[model samples]
Target: MTRAPNEDAIWVALVDDYDVVVKGVATMLDPYRDRVLVAELDTDRPVKDDVDIALYDSFAQPESDQEQIKVLLANPRARKVVVYTWNFHPELVEAARALGTHGYLSKALPARDLVAALEAVHAGEIVFSDPPSRMRTPTSQDWPGRQEGLTDREAEILALITQGKNNADICEVTYLAPNTVKSYVRNLYRKIEVDSRTQAVVWGVRHGFLPDHHRIDHWRGGP
Candidate 1:
């Protein structure tokens, strides 16, 4: 995927099931077309030859997303496969990298940074966004559900549950095992006076516990 000294453009392919996003990203990158060439592959068939990199946007994927990476890897033209996603959990980044993903970039990155990441990947660099450290001790401010006496971990789990993630999904993001997640869910439910996921979600909504702005920045036309 190396370009000659005179060659400045790096060919890229946007892979996603949503046509609107593909088109939207294409438009966003139009300003940098000379530097990052959006390949003319068929929209119906995202994987194709002559692509230097494949940017897979995991918008609403399940917990088991390795198969998605494998599918992109199977494409001979996708010399480098990158996962651009809103899910920037440390655990998810490590999992994607373990599967040989060249880059695990956050969707919140600006267009220029995204292009830089692709170029870095093409140059044989393993790129990943710096995920928040789970080891950091949480202060009262860290717990959005502090008034309810929910621990930092419990608050995080509740936020994910509000976003419709199951135990497996929560495990992937939090790096917690299934049993640990279940235990946390049980504890949080009791703390919040909820017995089921449905009640938890309702509580989260009523208390204004939505996914953080950083995670949803892409939708609001931010970097």
Candidate 2:
């Protein structure tokens, strides 16, 4: 059951380069607003609020290897930086942990479980989700190309392609094996009906595959 709103609700800021991806996470946590208030949604910008948690959504963004997490961790306004991602390779998790990330959550979690995890992290506990099952259950999360029938992973690959990343760059950023990256590229190409990398990049550009370069401070009422 939905609880009454608490004045001390865990203030959360959803951070990602894609507005749709961040909004999707906000919508997933909407039913639990009383427990977790999504105060800000930042796209390609540093968070400006004094929030309890900065949930960094890794949809199409660089993973543990990149500097985004470090940037979030450096923000004094954000009390804690947690990575909300689909990739859970041990190396990536260790990298994030080494970078002082407070929590590492999975995209496979249901809304309620996700809220609980955030609460745990707020209470000064380091949290990490179990390795997701190979056959994953569908959740109410969103990605850039979902409307066009691309899974979140496929959408991520396409987004990187749109950013002018070659297969090698994608593999490095995503931590996927060379073969796995090639396979994802192949599948996404078929889904988008493109015959070449150039065609795929063109389709991605036309279909909102690029990162958003704005911020939405919901409480203040505009970007």
Candidate 3:
């Protein structure tokens, strides 16, 4: 049965760089409007609205050094920050926790579950299902580029490139200078034997790094 929204709804802000994705998520939460009062809709900007939680969706975005999370956490308007993305890699989860994310949700979650997670997080609970702890096992499966001779950071950058993020986008998320990003791109091309972004993306998709997983197939344990 559908539970009625709480009388004291949690104020939320959906933050992302894509308007369509942000607005789409907002629409999905519309049914639970009574439970989650979406107070702000922003695209990669400092959240100005006072909200209980800031949901940052890494939709079509590259994996970075959790810089954006820091930005969100620094903003006084948002009391807590949650990452809603398809990057279920174990390293990303550790990064999120290290950055102090209240919750880390996979994009595959249904709206109902997402709502419940938001409610729990607002109620002072940490929620996470992606990257099950076991996946963190010291094995090759944990690293996407282990066989391909790419460092974790390189693989991360390559993953972003596969998502069609340009140098500026990667730099912004990874907190790297433009020139440094260019260097990474050059190194990735050399390591992956791809001369251009197109070739690199092709390699990435074939290597299971581009299309983020929907479920935690490599998880080890824990919530």
Candidate 4:
């Protein structure tokens, strides 16, 4: 299904601090200069500004993984982000879905596959499945396994934080002391790679399954 390169160029932001990866990808994609714009970004890049697509390494911890994803998805210009990695984790895919990722593929995949994945996502299909590898199937049964790898419980606590819950309400609901909850929320923001409830809400809506300010989950009679 290799069609003519759609008339518009796809702007891609390569968000990695490593020089070799950035340089290698850039060199590999040199032929498509007119079609691809590659910029190696760290935290310093204004993530919310502009981008059309992204190729990132999300084969890591949920905390770090989501952090990198937020940087790309937050961009108004970015419509899709394809995570390139050697090892694909099931939980990472789940988080990416919540975060609105376009798709992800293996770094070991052929170069043609990578380009095809990029084009596929850019063309409006969000490919979320990872082929069988060392990773286990992404069943709901794997939920506990997914949550277990967190560097801290604070981030897990943040997952339960609804938009309307205040510090006092959270203390009562979570059964944590008020000061502890506040500290946890602060740390959670740093952990899940978001700043405010709004960002977290957006993050949840895109990659995780959660209700928005509209409280649609409540309306659905969900617990």
Candidate 5:
């Protein structure tokens, strides 16, 4: 589908069996009229054009699992999808990211907040979890995102590690297991050639990956 650059168009599509959710959003965006064009999709029909953002309500009868989500994400313009569901599973969040979704806003957040989320994703920044996440810090030697080329999830875990949390803590916050966090750390260390946390911190700081304003002490379980 072709999108015209003439208008600051935010083509939004709603994939949900529940009509109320779609209607509610339509009513909410009613005031913002021409700024956003909302498309309410019934499962039977094909998504008309390449929309800028798509909202999927996973709890609906037809359900939208990873596989279904994978299909929806095939559209190049549907990069900034905001998913809503009854469950707040971190694994689901990981899955959505893997499927190319830029944000995951819960249905529980106020209706108005949903607009803010759509606005945020449309602005080109990612919103994985609501209420900005507080992750544990990893060492300087193994900074986040610049590993010997770790996967996106690995980079995410590394960023959490640098926030100063222990493996168990990371698991609790991310809904991952302590052992899994350890495994990621060990693998990342090996890939990045970092021996210890101290070395990771030193190297990270040197490379500017560890911002000066952010200290690692708090991430290590300090208050």
Candidate 6:
């Protein structure tokens, strides 16, 4: 049966290729079970159960302008789709809006604020978090290289590199300046103790940098 928002908690599905990323968000929202119930955590599979929102996490995945947004929006099970991302470039935001996304939220938002935003979106309001002044590492979230002293941004860059994205590709996808992308690459290389791209890719392969290529079925429990 299709579920609708009522007096109960808003049902949300966390979408991302990395289990750690979506699980982090789920854990952040766990305390707010009365206001938000994370009904699904979709790694690569389509969300099965009907949900009020599909929170698309942009960790190691394509930005908002890509086809994934359309895929999420097309799923009838997801009543709304929201881009949960750190990149809030104007073009990216506009593109998502043009594509009919219900919201574009920043990763910097605290768990409480995130829940509030989700509630607002569920109430039929098109919401967008103010462009963050700076991309501070969200302490509550998790990424691939967090254990090795790599910040979320650094870990994202390394994941892209592992996926065979060059510096130019990185800049295009991340909306970062050429020099900035180079700097991130260098920093991640240093943190991972690799001196070259090939070495970094090898290390990334060994240490969970590659994305989980398949969707997780029966996540938490079978739908």
| Number of the top TM-score candidate | 6
**Local accuracy by lDDT, each model:** 0.67, 0.79, 0.68, 0.53, 0.56, 0.82
Q: Which regions in candidate 5 have their CA more than 4 angstroms from the true location? A: 1-6, 42-45, 61-64, 77-79, 131-223
Worst 10 residues of 1 by lDDT: 214-223
The reply for model 6, stretches above 4 Å from the true place, is 1-7, 42-46, 63-65, 216-223
Ten-residue region with minimum lDDT total, candidate 4: 214-223
lDDT of 1 by residue, 32-129 (tens): 77788875345333232466788876543435367777766765666888897656665677778888999987656667877788889989999987
**Whole-model lDDT, candidate 6?**
0.82
Tens-digit lDDT string for candidate 5 (1-223): 4565636857787664334445555666655546677765544444445677877655322122565465556655465566755345656677778777777765455545666778788999887655334332212212234435764356545554554555676676556677877888898777767998766655544533432211111111211
Q: In angstroms, what RMSD does candidate 3 have relative to the true structure?
A: 12.2
Order the candidates by lDDT, highest first: 6, 2, 3, 1, 5, 4
What TM-score, over all chains together, does every model reach? 0.56, 0.87, 0.57, 0.49, 0.49, 0.89
Better by lDDT, candidate 6 or 2? 6
Give the number of colliding residue pairs in candidate 4: 7
Clashes of 5: 21
Q: Write the per-residue lDDT of candidate 4 for residues 89-175, one digit (tens) a residue.
A: 455567767887778776555444566677778888987646545433212111111343332234335445534456676565444
Candidate 2 lDDT over residue span 28-58, tens digit each: 9999998999865534444445788988887
How do the residues 83-180 of candidate 3 rate in per-residue lDDT, one tens digit apiece? 98655666678888988899998666777888999999999999986644322211211246657777545766887887888888887666668987
For the record, the alpha-carbon RMSD of candidate 4 to the native fold, in angstroms, is 14.3
Which pairs of residues clash in candidate 2, taking residues 3 or more apart in a chain or in different chains? Answer: none
Q: Provide the clashing-pair count of each candidate structure.
A: 1, 0, 6, 7, 21, 0
